[model samples]
Target: MSKFDSLYIAAKEKLLAAKNIAMVTHINPDGDCTGAALAVRKLLLALGKDADIYNEQGFPSFMEFLRGDAVFNRYTQEDGVEYDLTVFIDCGNIDRAGKVAWVCEKSDFIINIDHHSTNPMFGDINIVDSTASASGLLIYDFFKACGVEITLEVANFLYVAIMMDTGNFSYSNTDKRTHDVAGDLLELGVDPSVLTQKILRSTTYNKLKLTAMAIDTLHMYCDGKIAVIHASKAMYNATGTDSSDSEGFVGMIRDIKDVGFAVFLRDTTDGKLVKVSIRSNLDVDVSKIAAEYNGGGHYSAAGCSIEGKIPDVEEIIVKRLSEEL
Candidate 1:
């Protein structure tokens, strides 16, 4: 067994010993975090334990296609809820859990499962493997080690998790093992053609409007090396969309040839915070830039949340990216 297998054994032992379990993912949950958390919850349930997922921000609108939407409890700091183990999936640190961090602290045992290199390893059992293309990949390995059968439902969850995190296998993180795992999932009844349509091609009319608004704000800086876009509250209101609708806007700008990096900034539901997503070409390590703002992710894709006016935030980010280039 590899190191992850041993950790999986320990995780399995902990789950079997526990009665109530809470699986928590990071704030502004993405497909990787949501899918990993939900998949693990199902596996825990199969072991005859009570398990549920807690996410501070619920699923993005585009990810409604994934399974287990209702089971996610939007964290509200309610009292009297308890758990023996709290598994943090795809979160680099406890703070990334946002409002759910309190629950993680209250839990008797904590398990941190993630693929980010900057993870702080702040759990009783830390399964932090940066080499894994996605956290769901680690969860898949965990399921295999526990001898849990990969049902069609479970297979779809892991499939979406891996596919989204690897950027449909177009990202550098997608390697031989990633493809092999995807092939296994395909054999288990995951239809790539249908999944691709739902995840990539399918979009709401509101999302298209939001994309247009964001593109209108696009500005290239550092002599076209950096492409930046900003979304404001007015745009959200006009487009009948939220931050989630602008999911792929950064990637849209990233496709521009000769643009070394792309940036997307949007006002949070609470106007106090601006969420920044960064994507980079081969020339830059965007994770380092995100880390400077107390965010973390893969080298090619990363994000951070900043407290400032959107314009100021955009200017500061361009300055930072300029330094990086």
Candidate 2:
């Protein structure tokens, strides 16, 4: 049996043994994180366990259609509540859990479920598969192995997790097993058209305006081999858009014919910290770049937060990425 199989069995045994459970994902959660947390929440509820999903911030409205009401308890030190077990989905390290890290520290048992290669194996039980498209897919397999029914709700949550993490099956992580799992989910009534429309095609007017502005300021570097864009705090105020609306803007630069790398820079709430998201089509390992800033993720897609003005952050990233070019 594979290591994942062993870990899955051990984790399942623990789940069956636990009473109160809490689930958490990384801060600024994406599809994989939210979907995995929701899927696990549903699965634990099916098994007659108390599972609560916790995250510091809310997800974008586009992801609201997934499941479990996206009920995230804001992370705070004074909550004074602890769990028999805490399951962290799609978070590589404890710190990624943000303020919820305190909750994790208080748990009697911790389970770290993720697909990132950089996972620190911080949990009492770490079930990480670097090759898996999404942690939700692995969790789905765990439920299946444990003889849990694959209900429509579970299928929908897992589908969103897998679809988004693999870029709708366009990323290098897609494999035969990924397709097989997706096919099974489809048979179980995952409405691809509806989910796609809700997740990808639907956008508010303010988001559209922000996208247009981002596109207008798109800059090409390395002789058009790299593209970069920035969204300052002012941009959000001008467009009446939240930082969440900046999602997917980097992909637009990736469409540039000759560009191998795309970077999106945005000033965070602190104004002094700039969030840098990097996407690469091939060869260039953006994870390595993100690591330079103490961040980690997949080779093709990664992100980091830098303390600098937007312009300075942009110049630093461009200079660092030039080495890869």
RMSD of each: 1.6, 1.7
Q: Which stretches of candidate 2 lie over 4 Å from their true place?
A: 1-3, 68-70
**Per-residue C-alpha lDDT of model 2 across residues 202-308, encoded as one tens digit per residue:** 88899888898888888888899889998988889999987778877888898889888899998855469998989998797788778879888888988888998
Best by TM-score: 1
Clashes of 2: 0
Assess candidate 1 and give its lDDT. 0.85
- Alpha carbon lDDT at 265, candidate 1: 92
Q: How many clashing pairs per prediction, in order?
A: 0, 0
* Candidate 1, residue 163: how far the Cα is off, in Å: 0.8
Quote model 2's TM-score. Answer: 0.95
Error of 2 at 321 (Å): 0.6
Model 2, residue 19: distance off in Å is 3.4
Q: Which residue pairs in model 1 clash with each other?
A: none
TM-score of 1: 0.95
